[model samples]
Target: MVSSPSATPASALSAHAITAHMGPCAILHDIHLALAPGRWTSIVGPNGAGKSTLLRVLAGLQSCTGSVQLLGRALADWPRRERARTLSWLGQNESAADDLTVYDVAMLGRLPHQAWLAPPSSADHAAVEQALRATQAWDWRTRALGQLSGGERQRVLLARALAVQAQVLLMDEPLANLDPPHQADWLLLVRELVARGHTVVSVLHEVSFALQADDVAVLAAGRLRHHGSTQDAASHRALEQVFDQRIAITQAAGMWLALPRLERPAAPAPSAAAPVSA
Candidate 1:
């Protein structure tokens, strides 16, 4: 059973009776969710659980039967450029021109704020530099995207998203190619964003990292199993059950950890060979 939303400031984003379909296959059922402002919420689930699909719907990048609202306004009512400026999206394996320099790629994020066919303004340049620095990609600003490693490319993409300076960020697998240290850096960056009153919604496969968010939204088979504070016992139970009870959540070193609950194999069926009296 899903718990109600914990006490929070006005919601930054919300969806009501959200149902989505791809061809004849239903990707998401009637779902309702609200994300709080100035906080981080992680969406987690098994494979094919519609985590990414739901994110796309919230970003206004996908079509669905239900209503999605951004800051008390219907998403559909926002102008295209206004919507782009208000909500930023960083998709998994996002494609960009291989020839573009790191700085140029990140500058694309400023498009919504720039006048048509106009050169980037001082504000745009500053935003790009800040974003690159935040992602630790500033040193590689002069390099082409094709010249970077997968991890480096991912950082550049993240910088691009950060450059948008949007109030709400929707990230799908933002840690895809990040190593442990870089993943830790990403966590710090998210904390900073939340501290600054931005809303962050991420779909993360890393269960341990997901637990670090202010809230966890568990999905299973295109349905919302639970949505509650990470510290809530009900949230932990839903998380374990969604993974078939194959994991256990434990606290250690002042943080939560999702450890595997490995099952011991059934003692190999008494050797089928006829045992001779030795």
Candidate 2:
């Protein structure tokens, strides 16, 4: 049900001096970001680092200071339906009604393009089917949401987002609950989206997975620590620092890998303790 915007040469999404506050605490602070067309950008940071808040702002779900632009136009200027059609969002812990079938839930992605009382059209059906197949969820189309396992449900949600077919996608922890194989599948789907000129921005806790992205943004204490290519030294350092230096980044098989460091054994207590007791 998502509608494509008129072709534009500008970036898919941009945020300038974005700041969000929750009562006495600030969730985001003066953040600036942009997602180029046909590219993948991963937001990586420690827990409570405001990555999720930034995604919410980009999705137009959270109010904040500063401006967000979609396809060169101010985000606030777009009609709700138009904006929804142009930008699709997959939140960190999205849940669907337990009684709804997978097919029915995926069909909701078309809501932005549907008339108030209009039933699903042939195009909608085709889009939903393609999306489900893309995410390998077509086989479970008729299953109730509650019947699926955690990973299965996550795939279904991804299918729902894909069905929107928006030019820009913002996903928060899309790999949540996914097995390694399914996670690989999700990565492939993202690459396909970018190949077709779609822009993607994802917040990921998996440092290794984030390394696969075309670019990475690291956040700390509600501020941007680094925003650049994954190969950039600053990005690597920020990523390492955010993780408390517990992870080591290395190139293996020409691919960047973030491996956790083995804990070092503690040194034996000094023999002087025995003499002190005597």
Candidate 3:
């Protein structure tokens, strides 16, 4: 489930000896992560590396053997509403009702703050408006979800998550279906959130974008290979090794860029001309 908008205390979250499994198959192993307070961190790894699973564990949406702490309290000890206020999640490939308007979907984020069967308060409207605008979806507020293109629908879903206004935001592949310009907008929004002292954690497939975060958690084969500031030489080395050294991190335009290192195909063997008739 995607998290609703919320306003909770800005605090650090961490895990101790966390392990997760699905039936007989283990998905994560003794994972430990300490997220920086009031900053942006990204979890990046190859497919099937447990990146999304780890994010779910941190959000308390998945069961695990280890313990998780939120704002200095056991995650399980917090009331559901309190947890909702503290964490806002944006998941990959989220779906909404085709008949629902963009405004209706985004308003869901305000549910945690509204009374049962009650109308949206002034603050609720303000938050939704702000989120929609930030995601550049305000122009289609009244449009039905079914009418929008894939990228537009993605924006509406993001607006819904943003409306929650939670202190700890966790997103999985927030840039899916977005063009380069909107992807840039998403990054800027992340920067704005961090600037306002909010903590953001994301699982990104785009390594270059992930490198821009304040801190990084690099995972490989379901284990934490490295966790530190992105600028650290150790982080870059870990990132390269995780991808089997198929990419090299370099400085370009004053920012770190992940450039793929492709090996040229061997020259084709000389063709053997046998008894071919013209």
Writing each residue's lDDT as its tens digit, candidate 2 over 63-153 gives: 9999999888899999999888889999978999999999999999999979999999998999999999998999999999999999999
Candidate 1 lDDT, 1-278, residue by residue in tens: 01123544378899999999999999999999999887899999999999999999999988999999988789999999988888999999998999999999999999999999999999999999999999999999999999999999999999999998998999999999999999999999999998887899999999999999999999999999999999999999999999988899999999898999889535666758886897
Better of 1 and 3 by TM-score: 1
Q: Which of the numbered candidates is closest to the native, going by highest lDDT?
A: 1
TM-score of 1: 0.92
What TM-score would candidate 3 get against the native?
A: 0.91
lDDT of 1 at 158: 97
Candidate 3 clashes: the total is 6
RMSD of each: 6.0, 3.7, 6.0
Runs of candidate 3 exceeding 4 Å displacement:
1-11, 264-278
TM-scores for every predicted model: 0.92, 0.91, 0.91
lDDT of each: 0.93, 0.90, 0.89
lDDT of 3 by residue, 39-98 (tens): 899999888999999999999988899999876678899888777877888888889899
Better of 1 and 3 by lDDT: 1
